[model samples]
Target: MTTFRASGPPPAADPAVVVVTDLIVFAKHLRLLDAARLRGVTPLFVFGPETAGRDLARHRADPDHPLSRVPDGDVVHVPDTSLETLLRGVAPWLRERRVRAVLNVGEVFVEAAGALAQSLGLPGPGTHAAQVCRNKLLQRLAAPALAPRWTVLGADRAGDAERFGAYPAVLKPASRMSSSGVRAVAGPADVVPLLPEYGPGELVLLEERITGREYSVESLVRDGVVLWAGITAKDTNEADTAFFTETGHTSPAPHLTPAQEALLLDANSAFLGAVRFGTGMSHTEFRLTGGDRVVLMEAAARPPGDAITRLWRLATGMDQDAALLDLALGTDPVTAPPRRRARQVYLDHPRGLLTDVRADDVPVHWVGERGRWPDLPPAAADAPSRGHAVLVSRSRGDLLGDQADSRGRSVSVVLDGPLGADLDAVARDAARAVTISAVPLTPAGRTGEAVR
Candidate 1:
């Protein structure tokens, strides 16, 4: 069959940028939105029904909420979440709005963004690239040499004792993010119960866990070239439990040996290339094993989560959000020289119902000194804290030991300061100053007496 191909001269002027966001969480693209406005780019925001309604409710309830501050005309709502439906709905809207690019800042919206870009002939990393980055099995398959040994098995096979006789393997949904449905399978028993979390025929990855320090490399790529890359030191709850929940992170990781650094750069380059990742911001995680071996964990085509964007700006004087916006608009990304060190310390709390939080004792140097208590949802897990603090210090100190807590109830903090600042000491003092009290939750889901 002969196919007719459409050919035309390029437009003299580029279209505006549109960002598609979701409702699972708050809109994290506010900084990018503001930057686009400052650059005379009135970007339009496309939100799904869930996200748009939630944003409206949140803004109405709290006037200071970022969504409340957005102009009414700048928002558009799409009812469908499926990639094909979303593309069909958005492609016409983009052409109508003269949108030059479609930016997907959240994991849920990446595939849609790629589809939109392809249909609209805009700049993007393509749908296949996004899928490779999203699915763990695809990532491992794409870069087997860089990734640790892993196997993809259906729910039924996940419980096979002989298959996973290798204890200490990590089991997770092939394409899930934010550690959802992720667990450590020390034995066969641990595998069976968690298999039901996946659908009847859903695929899961059983990976041989690499023991070592965990780190994430945040990079900005333009035309398949890594423009800038920075390493962030990560601390997780691995020592005390099988769950690898993140507890803290320090940017421009000051402890990487020369060999480890070399391995990281090499592995990241190889993995990104293997996946055919072309443009936009990416966050690739790695583990530095005892023998100075670097093992690839996974990567995302979007920006890093967990306030890493703010940490990057604090540490390197570069606004990653802004860089992403520029890339979406096909402009040169904003770059800056590294100016200081940055760290994020997540407060750990015992499993319970939070009753009261106090940060009065927190030192004056902490950035978030407004004494605001974090909003505690009724059935929320004590793992991630909403009320954390930020500080900019002058040096790095021995803060790791001081911030360490067996129960994991310490408040999280993000800080940036000069090279010689005693950040460790500052962090220790901040940890000592903050106190959180919660009522223990019994196995029956009832609240008990308050505990500190």
Candidate 2:
């Protein structure tokens, strides 16, 4: 069952941008809201039940919550985020307000949001690009030249996983995010058992694992032209032994040679061209093989998640949020040269019940702000010359699962330093600065002392 609820008064005649997204995490996405307000555009947020239910209720109850900054008419909660439902639910807003664009912030609903934008003759990535971006199989099919060797198994024929005969391969869902259900399989034996874990009637892809360094290229496009692209070096939890869960990221990737960086940029440009991406931001992941061969793992028609945008801002002094808004408003995006290095590392913790997590002793200056966001730096000359901060995702009493995927991880630390500084050392020091405590559970349901 789906429900659409639009409360409060009707919106004003000012130009508005409809943002199709899920939960609102201020720590990561406050720049988006700040950007809209700074640009004099009203933001109309369309949320699904997953966000609208508990999270929305909590935000509405708390007067200090960031959602309180937004007008009540601008927040529309729908039971489902399907395209038909969004169009119907948003029709009234479009009729009442002067809507100029529709932007997508969540990976799962990119296609629906693009279609919504197109239906109203607004700027967007378009359905074709969004569709290709959403489905891994479609991405592989559309750009075979850029992808690694791969094969697909339809929901009806998923039992034939072993038929591919590919060893040391990667098994991933056709349409999922956050590295969920993405695993590195050694052989057919490892592949068969995982088949039952997938949802019934879900498409899966098995591909030859391209070995080497992993990185992501984030670009802002306007009228099919890429205004700028930033490369972010990525590291995964290889010790987990199965899933490719990202653990760290460094923007303006430190060690890439000129030639290697050029190859990655060209491949990213080729991918954007192949998909015929019209406008907005793109986050594309790639694996650089032995001979500098760039293989596309996947791409999303949205800003890179996990505070990578913050890294970019600290590294290059570019306001990616404002750049994204510029593209949505049918204008060219602004760019800046790299001036520093920024890194984000997710800390490791034991599997048990989380008791305490803190980095209070670390002299860290966290990026992003709630108030005076429009006046915050890069724009300000006195922006912190060096910065570091910690973010804890899980709360006390939360049961911590094995690090099989991104959701299993609990906390992360972000650091900023000079361009020539050792990012590796900076990352290591940041990790050691934090402290976590978890109480392990015994097989017979007994709880052990808190382990720090």
Candidate 3:
């Protein structure tokens, strides 16, 4: 008997990273993508949702849109008029270029892009599987133990009073990402009537409300193997609890022992496998109460939004964007064991109109009015609204602390530690307080520098 070894040639393009961003320009994310491109991989950008969101028909450009600043050569921009259209447009390009893997960068663009690539016969997840993850109602249709309680109702009908949760239940938008319109409904008054009005254009997923701590698990897939992963506990701000504005988070599995971590990770892994996640990024958010009671909120086929990617990177010393880029490039990010402890990530939750900004009171570097920060707001104190100018903060405390500062009634920060809150009440208040209105400003101000 003889032992023989087969060898092939060296590798080609580093796994190609495909990110879907609603184009405006000057977005910090471009920097993240740029870093990956420099490290052997190519960065491709997918721009979607032509009219900001579903509600707005008027087109307003995001001054800080990542591409405005990033070099065009480094990115491949695929304009999105509609999800279906965007995919068909990009399919030929991906095929011609021979893309290795696709990184669904945002909630809005993930399923459509993944589906389109697969349909084009590209190596990626099929459209139906992406639908399972993107549609809240569909994701809830898991195995009995896996599926959440309650039913997936049409947004157009009246939610039956009897079928509603005995206690308060949560409502999910059909294709929502982030805390984008996640609501808590107590009984018929809240759940039933929503069907005729709120549920019409959208598919509503009604889930039994589970009282417990909220945590997010971030994981990356490589050649079908779950190579690197971590879990973080979500700590929210009490003062500006409305809108479920994310306030704080801690890494290395906060308050969760080895057993709890294992359970949640297992849940996430199962959820991913069930949905047929062959490649790309997967992030899951769940509620963990005592006695092994868990309610799965969602599992997305995209990078974790709201700066959590930065948190995972800070804690693990792994540039998530880079890793994602590597995944798309077909190269796995080599993890360097582990080191730092107690590292956390945070972002600010804003209220009212965001007019003027002064960071360290030094005239706010690289930020201006108009173009999203459009010329700041009229300097009128005492008459401020709620949930206006949301700024991103690094520390956990500072992000949530901005709520009490009357000087910043319109602004809020996201940080760590704790803000004791009645999450249910906060959710309702936020829904009533903020309806996702715009600040009527852009990133570019009177001056040349662009503001975020």
Candidate 4:
């Protein structure tokens, strides 16, 4: 008897990674694609049914979108975004290629990505961490020490809102993002009415309103080790509305004593450990009480949204997107310390039918050098103007609603300068630069009203 080994040439295609997310995230953070390209790895995108439909509509409406160039062959449309469905759908397709890692860039479907990575023996945020990141209730259960007193309420249990731990409580959708359907309830009576806002049978978290300054921590971890971490101070619309929608963010958290910073990091690390976070960036929001106690608001297994990653890149000179790809590819990421302060401020308009939007022509004084930034706001393409770059997320005819959540914000202005620069003043100046005109709608949300 003779033992024989049969072998052939290697696979013709380049090594690849599975990216489980939609196009919106890629459109905002195009550098993630650039990172993959720079590493010479193919990114096979897997879009869920809902995302596929939304992406198709957006592409048909505007073929010039940043992510419109993705080759169709590299795209995979799945029936749904569940872990089992993703594995069953993509596993066979992946068998033909050398898949390196699985990554999720969207707010939802993190557990699906984590489980996919685990099944492939690749690095990810781990199954437990991903699941906890997806659900507010799971987050509370996973890290009770850092979580505020919280109770669960669903459409069927609307009465439980009255038995909540305290008054002036915050009601958050158990598994939603961008602060959608989240509001501050004044009292027990106020809770039942708001229940209708959420989808029927949706779980809601009723937590004691932890009063304090809110901040977010973005950390890059690999193999359970934190490589880089930074704190960002944030301002929310809670003062102007019942919802806690983030209106602004300052990187490096301009004001943090050494002790306070240490406490925040400790709490974040504890939460990650409890959740068994494995790899990738974690965005953890915290509220520091008057007594300096750090309370966890929520955490996500993906990078921070709303271009906070860009702020981090500008403030630290560390391209986290590159680091993220490096982590996925089984390599250590290089990081840099904070160099300058950066802030992003969102602009909102009066509730009405938007008629016109304009910005004063001002020279965009490049703080250090010109063309150094990769993805400046959309307004940057028009002309050099101001110390900030403005990006409008709405059109002239689009209806403007109350600044209740992230979706309601109209425009965004981003600015960065020396640590001593008065960014708040710059932000004010930037806000004044833009003019918004709208027609006042009737009280019934009809257009048969006066033009304002």
Candidate 5:
């Protein structure tokens, strides 16, 4: 899922870092270029469908591709489609290439691919670390002290719910990614119904929703040392806890004091160490209770999910994607962000087919290009229109309290003002302002597209 430019690394090590991906996308391909420049090492892009091994014929034909150009015959289009086959094919290659370490490029395959590759040869966090890193329960158990007071991990729904005593209990799939399957039960009635979906897990975190400020920190770690840290202040939307969408985040987290920040960093380091902080990058999310007490929520061994990498660069001038590649290839990372604060907002509309389009007056960054757009999907359905907006302002204070939303299906506007100004009614009135249209509902009763 990562790619880099042709720049090589320190001492110009040709370690043949392998990028294991099922499909090659453009942004990821560009990131590989960035990685090459930072790590000072050129890596091989290996695409594995798992039925075979490196397709040499394809490389021969397009010899200009980075994969084809790398050390000719180094083009490993590993033909294995399954994890086992991919690992088997990758093991000897690492050994043969004298690969010093194996760090999964990003928070992908939830470390499954990384685990398989590690098992065959080379050094990595291994299977256990991957599992713990991906599963919240195991992560919390691996470092109990770092997490807040937590208990109860089971699937009996009613019984478990009764046992745990009430609503607001957190439930998430053991292998679910993103916010795809995480739910928070606020009361008794919400418990029994979630069983069909959450009932299958051997364990789940029934966390006491600690009232506090939430933050996610990105850390660049190398050989047990946390090379650099960037903090993110989170803004979340909860429609009764079942759907929590992070609407936005501001980095260089303005709220944490020096002492609180230290505690967070120390706790994060401790958690990483306990979880075997191997190498590469990790994004750790935690809740700062009362703005001081830090509780570890989860640590993903990848760059912070979403396009926060750009936000980090704007806020601090650090290229995290490059940092990830640097440490992956055994080089020090560029972790410090340049002076300033920056923010990014993701429009998480209430799920339904994007019935209409509006907001003709808002600024947005589409793909790598910039310009004002119109009639875009409520959420972009494909490439050329990744749903996002980037507002880069040197004056961080000037951006605080700013809010952007699509006003119904016909109007899109961003209200920029103070950081915590009155946006409650603004958000509430959004549903009314935007013409909410109902497309023909599917037989499954789920929302479908209204393709304009």
Candidate 6:
């Protein structure tokens, strides 16, 4: 079911931009509207059919939410998933409002946003580019020079895995997000059993797993030119696990030689052009191999998720959300060099019921202001971090390496210090100071058993 909130004051006769958001709306998206309003742009928002009610409720409940302040007439709900349907429903409304630009704030709306922009003759990556960015197989094929060798296989084609001649290959859905159903398989036996998890008509991809440090290149592209690029250091689940959950990230990736930086820029540029990404912000992830080789993993036409937009502002004084808004409105983005380094470490915990958390020794600000946390469900394969801490450090060295373990992280600490400070040691010390205690769940048959 879908709902629209156009109960507030009427919007300007003509708005400057339209932002189409998906089911998984992020807080930054709301902030984008607020920033545009601050800049005298009357922004209109179109929500997807599957847009979460909880998200909308949260926004409406929060007095500071941009939606609460924006004109009621600016909010619209489009209950359609098909690009043609969405375009047809929204095109007339946009034309009536005279919106100058369109912004796709989430993955679900990328293709639709592109189609709508093209229909309106606005600046955007065309539908073809947006479609390529959404599908992993297409992204790899578009940039063969930078992507790892990969092949598309049917659900019943496990025997064909031998063609890759690789043991530790990655198998993933071609078009899923949030690393769902993405697994690193060691052998054909492992690959065959996992294939059935995908739907009958869905295609799966088997690709060589590039072993190296992982990083993401974030850029603002204008007219096919990259205006500014930033490198983010990434930490994922432990190497031995099949789960590829992202655990942490640091901006301005601590130490990158000039050659490595150039390689990332060159590869990113090539990949974006190959996909025909023309404008707006781009988030492209790559793996840096032992020989300084850069291999593309994936690219998205929209801004990055997982608090990257907030980190960029803290670390580099760049408001990526606002910059993307400006790009959508045909304005040049204003960017600045890093004034401080920022790091976000996710909290993980083991499988259990109620949990106790201790963070008395960690010297950092927690993301959510809470004195005590509620009990969490038993940790599943897709267990998300409880919360994270934001740290601003003067020294890049202070933030390095993976601080959380596979057992599960539950707390993140942020800190800031001088240029030569040991952020790594600080993070380790913070991790040591914080501990998550959970009582393990009993076996399936022991439902009546008492707590030990």
TM-score of each: 0.81, 0.90, 0.68, 0.87, 0.68, 0.81
Q: Which stretches of candidate 4 lie over 4 Å from their true place?
A: 1-10, 49-69, 154-158, 362-374, 377-386, 443-452
* Model 6 misplaced regions, further than 4 Å: 1-12, 88-92, 353-419, 432-452
Identify the runs in model 3 with alpha carbons over 4 angstroms from their true place: 1-18, 23-28, 31-36, 39-42, 50-84, 91-98, 119-126, 154-156, 192-199, 237-243, 336-338, 341-351, 359-452
Q: Candidate 1 has what TM-score? A: 0.81
RMSD values, in order shown:
8.5, 4.7, 10.9, 5.9, 9.9, 8.8
Candidate 4, residues 154-206, lDDT tens digits: the string is 54556787677588898899888898888998888888887778777788888
Number of the top lDDT candidate: 2
Q: Higher-lDDT candidate among 4 and 5?
A: 4
Per-residue accuracy of model 5 over 1-452 as CA lDDT, tens digit each: 12222232334446556665533222333456546645555565555552123333453345443443456544455554456666666655554454544445444454665575455454445566666887887887899886765666554556766777534556655555556555667765776676666545456556666557778888877777887887887776554335555665666676577898888888888888888867667788888887567888777876675446655665555555566666765668766643544454544333343344333234332321111122121211121212123222111111112122111112222222223333334433332333322333345765533221
- Per-residue CA lDDT of model 6 for 217-300, tens digit only, reads 898988788889888888898475786767777777778888998888888889988988888888999999985799988889
For residue 21, what is the lDDT in candidate 6?
79
Model 6 C-alpha RMSD vs. true structure (Å) is 8.8
Once superposed on the true structure, which residue ranges of model 1 sit more than 4 Å away at CA? 1-15, 23-26, 49-54, 60-66, 88-92, 158-161, 361-411, 439-452
Tens digits of lDDT, candidate 2, 8-104: 3344467788888766333356577778888899889887755637657566566765677787788888878688888877888866777787888
Give the winner by TM-score. Answer: 2
Question: Ten consecutive residues with minimal summed lDDT in candidate 3?
Answer: 1-10
**lDDT, candidates in the order shown:** 0.65, 0.77, 0.51, 0.76, 0.54, 0.67
Off by over 4 Å in 2: 1-12, 24-27, 155-159, 363-387, 443-452
The positional error of residue 90 in candidate 3, measured at the CA in angstroms, is: 3.0
lDDT of 1 at 280: 84
Residue 181, model 5, lDDT? 51
